[model samples]
Target: MQKIKLFTDSTSDLSKQLLNEHRIDVVPLSVVFADKAFKDGQEINTEKMYNIIDENGKLPKTSAPSPQDFIDAFKPYIDDGYEIIYIGLSSDLSVTCQNASLASQSLDGKVHVVDSKNLSTGIGLLVLKAADFINEGFSSEEVAQKVRNLVEKVETEFVINTLEYLHKGGRCSGVQNFVGNMLKIRPVVKVVDGGMILAQKTRGKRKKALKTLLKNALKNKKEITEDRIFVTHSMDSEGAEYLKAELEKEVKGQVIITDAGCVISSHCGPKTVGILYIKK
Candidate 1:
């Protein structure tokens, strides 16, 4: 049987090391700052992007890879006689999915594109699962169906330390007032269906919000296992580590910590805390 190739973009928040270890391919998305453009993980690093955002008072805007970029990325696998499975960030959030689909159409029948319906490690987690299925000898279609089913089961929740970034990006529609008025409140945001939704609002401090986030994660703990919980942060190492420790204490299994990439950090901003878990 021919091996199946798995592809995802930087929006998945998957690290280069992880992608290499899993033998998954990643197409780079473009990050634009002021007038210059850089490939999401290729041309710029997360620290550099965040530093620019901090100093410039604006997060760099992001763009999906051009159809040609996807075409070029998929060509190698097709040449190697490997079937391609491209898992991308939610279509509702980015045009990456559409671009990948268009590229697939151009590839004839060799490439398959899938909309993860989630973002950050939420989509990364699904990519990891798809790789597992591929290794288990599942066909490309079977792997795609499994991913689609699991995408619905996975959930993401985050707490932004401030709403300045959201307000700046014009993504503050649902949580604007609450985030603006309550300086003491930390709102927990979740991905519902295909969009980001405010899950709960609470006040106190960052630590308290971290605690609340984990407590809420445990509410659906039965669906999670040792290796399934993914904790991501936007340049908030201490907070990410804190959440990881808390999850290890509460969850029945091990928790993994991943850095939020430029694509997600652009929206969530720095000091954001979040957990992506597969729910029962």
Candidate 2:
């Protein structure tokens, strides 16, 4: 059996510790500002990105990594006689998956790209599972198939503290942004069928919105797998901790807190917290 190697993009929002521990390779997406471009999680981080956004009052443009980037990342492993499997962010959200596919075509079947159909820790959850299957002696093909099957089982939902970022990113209209901020309306964005949708809107403070998100997640606890869950945030340690503490009381899984990368934070903005897990 050929050795299996795992690859993922920076949008996975996985912590460096997890990436190093699992031996995962990451191709970083670009976070472009009006003045310069930085590699997500490398040249820039969440706090610095947030500060730039605040200073400029503009949301940075995030671009998917080029096909060449994936090719370069996979070439070293292929030369070492390993089959590569790359799990990327949702194709619906970014062209990162498509670029990976293009890169795979040039690798002579040594690479398999899986569209996570989700983002952030939603992708992280699947990548970790792929690592587990590979460690259990599953063939590269088997590991890819097993991870793809779990794509739809992943549940991802986040609460936005403000609509300013959404408006700047063209996801929300200026009027909606104005009204939402005026009313302190927070929307819970959920990943459904490979796209993000407004799952629910809560009118009140951010605390109320976070509680609503927690309630929605717990209501489906029976279906949630007790393996591992991720609490990913963009400078929202308070919200992440609240969700983690509440979730730990109900679910047996380990709740991990991770900082969102620049790519994710550019769109979601600061104080955006998401809970991601695979369902049984």
Candidate 3:
């Protein structure tokens, strides 16, 4: 039987170690600062992006890879006679999936593109699920079907330290209530149906927001997968440690922690944290 290949974009925010462990192929998105552009994980890093955003008072423009980029990444695996599955970020969130879809046309039916309908570690969870199925000797088609089934099962949400980034990035204009009041209103944002939606709102205090995050998780703990849980943060290493400890106490499996990548940080800003997992 031919080997199965798994691919994801940098927006998945998977760590280099995790990607290497699974031998997962990754296509990078671009974070552009004016005329200059840098690869998501290669040329520029999350820290540099955050520093630039701080100094510039604006978020850098993020762009998905062109079809050519995905095409190049797909060709090698397809040439190796291995079936290809490219799991992508949310369609509503970015054009990454569309690019992957366009690239799929170059290959035969051997290449499959899946819309994770998620971003950050939400996308990572689906990729891991596909890897799990492949490890069980499942075919590419089987992996695709299994991952798609797990897509909705994977729940994703985050709490930003402030909504300033959203306002500065011109994303949350409609939520003018949180404009100047972001310091006092910490909204728990969730990924639902391929878009970011406000899940809950708490006090301006970071601790309050964290409690809300943990509260929601505990309420829904029965539905979350017990195998692995991801605690993803944009900086906030200390907060990630606390969140990971709290999560490990409630979860049966290992708690994997990762810092969100530059592309993701550009939108959410710094000091943001999220807990991601698949449903049981």
Candidate 4:
């Protein structure tokens, strides 16, 4: 029997410590600024990405890793007689999973790709479960199937501090974006069916925005798996900490906080925060 190797993309928003501790690998996407590119978790880290966004007052563009990048990552584990299971970001949101699927075709069945249908710690939670299964001596195929089943149950929600990033990135209309910025209308968005959509809106300062986010996103906190909660942020430590404190009262378990990697940071911008958990 061969050992199972776990992998995921940088959009998983998993910390390097977590990845290294689990021996999980990541294929990084590109965050481009002014025609210059940097790998998500490598060349450009989360803090640097956020600082650049703050300095330029513009959201950087994010590109999926090439199929070749997946190939490069998959080959080593395969050559070492290991079966690879790569859990990737949502296909509806990014091309990362699509490229990973394409790259697996060349690995002669040694590599298996799981389209996580999620992002941030949404993908990270699935990857971590797969790793647990592997550690428990489950086969790669079994681990993949179990993790895939958890996809629809994962919940991810975020509130943007400002509409400036979304406006600059063309995610929202300039007129509404301008007005929202003027009036300080922070938006609360949720991930549904692998796509991000506006679930609600809140006006006023950061505290009010966060209050709305917690209420809207965690309305069904009873449904969340009691084992763990993930709070991922883009250089928003204060917000993340506040969220963590709030979430701790809802779920009696571990709440891990991680920085959103470059790909997620590029779109989410600085001072954005979110919570992820699996539904029971």
Q: Sort by TM-score, best first.
A: 2, 3, 4, 1
Clashing pairs in 4: none
Give the per-residue lDDT digits (tens) of candidate 3, residues 1-280: 7678899999999999999999998899999999999999989999988888778876889899999998888888888888889999899989999988988887888888899999999999889888988898888888898888888888888888877888888866746645537447777899999999988877766888887887787788878877778989998998889888998788786799998999889888788999888888
Error of 3 at 62 (Å): 0.8
The model with the greatest lDDT is 2
The segments of candidate 2 whose C-alpha lies over 4 angstroms from its true place after superposition are none
Error of 4 at 113 (Å): 0.9
Model 2 clashing residue pairs (backbone): none
What is the model-wide C-alpha lDDT for candidate 1? 0.84
Q: What is the TM-score of each predicted model, taking all chains together?
A: 0.94, 0.98, 0.96, 0.95
lDDT per residue for candidate 1 within 77-113, as digits (tens), equals: 7888888999998888888899888888878788878
Pairs that collide in candidate 3 are 184-204
For 1-280, candidate 2 gives per-residue lDDT tens digits of 6698999999999999999999998999989998688999889998998888889888889888999998999998999999999999999999999999999999999998899999999999999999999999999999999999999999999998989999999998999999999999999999998998999999998899999989989989999998899999999898899899999999999899999998888888889999999999
Our model 2 lands, by Cα RMSD against the true structure, at 1.0
Model 3 — which ten-residue stretch has the worst lDDT? 174-183
On TM-score, the candidate that comes out on top is 2
lDDT of each: 0.84, 0.92, 0.87, 0.85
For candidate 3, the TM-score is 0.96
So what's the TM-score on candidate 4?
Answer: 0.95
Clashes of each: 2, 0, 1, 0
Ranking by lDDT: 2, 3, 4, 1
